[model samples]
Target chain A: MYSSLIITNNIHSWVLSLMPAAVTGITEMMMIAMIYLTVFAVLGLFLVLMERKVAAWFQLRIGPNRVGFFGMFQTIADALKLLSKELTGTDKADKFLYNLAPYFLIISSLMALAVFPFSENLQAFDINIGIFFLIAISSIGVIGVLLGGWSSNNKFALIGAMRSGVQTISYELSVGLSLLTMILLTGSLQLSEIIEVQKSGWLIVQGHIPAVIAFMIYMISGTAETNRAPFDMVEAESELGAGFHTEYSGMKFAYFFLAEFINMFIIAAIGTTVFFGGWLSPFGITESIPWLGVFWFLLKAFALVFLMMWFRWTFPRLRVDQLLTLEWKYLLPINLFNIVLMAIIVWLNFTIQF
Target chain B: MSYFSDIYHGIQTLLTGMGVTGKYFLNSRKGAITQQYPDNRDTLKMFERFRGEVVMPHDENNEHSCTGCQKCEIACPNGSIEIIWDRQVDPETGKKKKMIDKHIYHFGMCTQCGLCVDACPSDAIKWAPNFENAVYDRSQLTRVLNKPGSKVRAGVE
Candidate 1:
């Protein structure tokens, strides 16, 4: 059955080759979608182990070191445990929404994986509106959070859901604005096209002062969107307990947990695509060393993940009011100013040869 | 002032922050702040004054200095001590005497307060450094100090 699908897809690609650019684009997009689902399932396993190890290092303790060599297979064991355990739902919960929330969360975040370019020709989709699709798909995760909280019929869960809703929506503006500056500079929303623009230099270096400011804004906003530490008031143990998924048990809880780590990877992957030049090597170095682009891409993504972990361990959770105020007062204004500065730089083509 | 001065000031602040982190990172490799309990058992050391389980010292002749005076039994606040006596006819004195047949001590109830050791007039008992007293069965914790055939000495009392 799968072999038939692959043959059909290849045939479709060949047929579209004769059409104009528009039909070929649709065929490429379908191939990208198929690859995205397969890669992300494998990536989720690695991410779970990485998050646990990172958490352990920050707290000065050893975590999950018994299953396999250096505890590599610990996540697999945990998944087995979750699978065998009975999933129990609370009597008070909205059963349908409670069960549906995890599926929504996982599907939406996984959808964002479509636009991430792993290498020069490795993108799942080369949509001209890739950034817009990414931002739109990413916000759908908040719907799952809200549903999970509200359906659980738990006060803490509801509060957590509400906090996540407010936090994600607020941070989205700054993240969108920051990416807008990049979109303006590249004059394209397609991730592959953005990489083409960065063939000579990464945006962080080439876009200069405004690019640096935009990168900072993007990092902070992305961290908030993932509900990472300092901004992780939603799942704050002392305050909202386990937050929106408080009533979920066994495999259902595991689904929510898995979605969180996947969300982290998605944020880091998108950030890499935008500011660090996706799969493009700096100064056109990949021409001599073709694999250098993938190496550079992974290096940047992992560094961003490490920074997120560092922020979680280092800072205290912000008070609800403080978090909102920082978003509105500080992040929004700085991002707006950054956009104006970027427009000036692009207009002057300051360092670019027209 | 100038853009170059602003850049220099930023670098100075960054270096100051990095310096503090560098000092602590270098110091951490010397030794961990907490001790590993099971791994370092041989070199495990505690304060000299730490009180552990009580032990009765026996001489080369297998004779303990306890007179069976029942002082420890009385001194124990928790009733953790028991003394059983056997009447024996002394060879030298030609009289029946009460000899300590068994000295049973229930360590499960022992708090290691050192009161019983201080209360004993003969100074036969002292604290032993065997703090790993955990056992599978609670009954095994009630120890019998005096062996089955052992008896108190003659005349020393």
Candidate 2:
């Protein structure tokens, strides 16, 4: 009876010891969130400026140099102007949902950042099913787009929402399938576990031919899923006059804009996590430095984002029919065959080293 | 066999298309070709017949040749011209003469049509190349051509 009492006391002390660590962790998480928000705001500003610069370069004109030095603060000035502008609601619209949609969109996209593993130990939540959680949460953002479109009561907006819904849902399957192949090979759903598997080498390098093929499929489908050009029929400026958020104005519109950029960052971050090995050093030399994973992860993600931007500015918008055909006919068949080929190759140990 | 050849043909066509872009990519770096407008204003080359804002030239004697004629105000299609008349006793003749009190021209509304300059019988007005007319206040944009003590040019007076 005395020995049992002593054991309970020890257990109590252990629990007491863990409390400080838990409190520290909570504080750390709060700090990280604040950082992420700050970074996201800054990134949005950078993207707006970069987009203007890129568009100007493409059109053979200089853009937005008068606001601040080299137009760096132009977006900030524009943001201030937009913030002060009155958000006018249309007369004939579903007032509640129209008001609510942008918030939902921004929230859904922001939630996606929770599961994304920046490095081995640097994740917000190391959920066992992190990959699935990310995919699921990111997909919820589409609901916001659809609601925004439908509630606006405008025909163009409704059509845009429909197009976005169809495109995003359809392309999500290909993105999932490509990711599924990676998950199958790694035999893990946890993002950190996936990175651990790729410690010896990146999945893109280790899995060889199939990995490259899967990567390509993921990129193509991911681009479509993000509603980027040339798959951006939903927001086709020429056809649908600002598209799904056509009736949205002021800060409500800003929320949608923020959501889009955040979504882009989320996809890029997930891609870095899944394929390139989140926080895993290339040569295993940087493993000692825990912070290096964050560096590498961001580098890879930004590279992917740059590629996406390049694709956006370079490619012309695809026709709706052409886009669907590309997905259903070409990408579907190619991905299916690639998956089968990957299965066979993995089973046979037929490695094609790049 | 024909299908395989078609694939090759498609690849060739794609490369050919990319070749055009590749050439332009190399050329874009050589010269930006973009006119940085505000920065390069000093070197901006406007044609001599560019037809900018109208200016009423002032003479050294603080005299203006304008006889308070309202022809230019009538000729203006947009009603952009406004001429205010001030009666003054002539120092030499000791007779009351109609003088243009103040030509308050709002260049913001001016189309640079040169109609006002053309209608001036005294030939005191000409087009000025001072195009840096952007102002923070809309009210301040309405400019008085003749200074308080200045006079119109001697050529027509």
Candidate 3:
């Protein structure tokens, strides 16, 4: 089934064949990086606009509509505003780590984007341990948050960073455990392999209750991991005034902002790929139209993203103690039991595998 | 058993909260409370008594009912209204008939208090609710109520 729809691989080889083998690798790498960066920039603007629009709709207000048609270019105008803004830093701030923080965040998210098997052939790099690589790389962004907050010399920034660090570290465990439960069903760590297994049926449908439970856990922790609302103590702007990136201004702030949206896209993309079946049309409805895979993938991802936005507007921000207790008391214990339950189910070959 | 029920109850409450927002998200057309100001400017109507600004009402003949009493001028808390009165001999009565030469309304300073409207004895001044009062210059904000060469309406002395 997967063999016929491998056009990107062929195009890649054909391009490589035209150039010398030595420079081909470098050229191809540069080409991939350029394309990914372009996608990342456009996607960042779009996600921000979508978030604001969703937020407005929930509050019964019209969001941006003054810029381009339906405020399509509002984010672009915002990007321009950020570009021309003056960079400001605290007088007593450490400059080196402060600057490097944004890069650490952006680079990690970018690296994770490379591993996702969008339409099988559309993947930039198909690593064997794709899920492991994703989990590992995605965690690096929190260090950036930590560094940015601590180096700023602002008390609020430090507190926000520490809160973010704790939230992310704890939530990551739930995210990983939930993913591991799915991994048991799929019998592989590679994202493509995971999606391929879903051809019979999506993992959520195959494993029934456990898969659904894992999915719920994944979504919650993923929200926390991204430091989005309800779990957005990291940048509780109302409380801490811009959180870890409090002192950052101009393009430095934009970098942090854009990286946040990109991280959100990454989490949604992963959720779509793992539980929802990346690039795989529902019930294999559009199976014949190979290019429609991208559409399917984006549709599922955007739906999940919208769900996150809904969560943001509906739930009030939890207190610090409540946030910690919610994780340690509820999600962690549930996830642990869920993993054990999944192990038993898998051992008994109880999954509805096709 | 209570712990399991508690989790179930928690999930139920969360879903209920989501349902409220989801209804709004889906029924946005029915739920939208925003009045798109610029697009609906032509259709937008203000309340008759909104008190956006004070204006001296003039009839089709460009004749007004102002007796130049300076009552509105005296009543204005912000001193936003100025009545420039000119005395002239009436064609019929041949007595000094006090007429308003100009009813200057400085909108920039006016707080839309409706005091001037309330104080007008001849019912000359009233509230106009056309709230889009923005202009490029401060001079444009100070408006003359009477049309040029217009006189007081008959039988309202």
Q: Lowest summed-lDDT stretch of 10 residues in model 3 chain A? A: A1-10
Ranking by TM-score: 3, 1, 2
Docking class of 1: incorrect
Question: What DockQ results for candidate 3?
Answer: 0.54
Residue-level lDDT for B74 in candidate 2: 85
Listed per model, the TM-scores of chain A against the true chain A are 0.88, 0.87, 0.95
Lowest-lDDT window of 10 residues in candidate 3 chain B? B47-56
Off by over 4 Å in 2: A1-35, A58-69, A351-354, B1-30, B45-157
Q: How far is candidate 2 from the true structure (C-alpha RMSD, Å)?
A: 8.6
Best by DockQ: 3
- For residues A230-283, what per-residue lDDT tens digits would candidate 2 score against the true structure? 788889999999899999888899888877877777778878888888777777
Clashing pairs in 1: none
* N/CA/C clash count, model 1: 0
**The TM-score obtained by chain A of candidate 1 when compared with the true chain A:** 0.88
Q: Score the docking of each candidate (DockQ).
A: 0.15, 0.14, 0.54
TM-score: model 3, chain A:
0.95
**How would the candidate models be sorted by lDDT, starting from the highest?**
3, 1, 2
lDDT of each: 0.79, 0.77, 0.88
Best by TM-score: 3
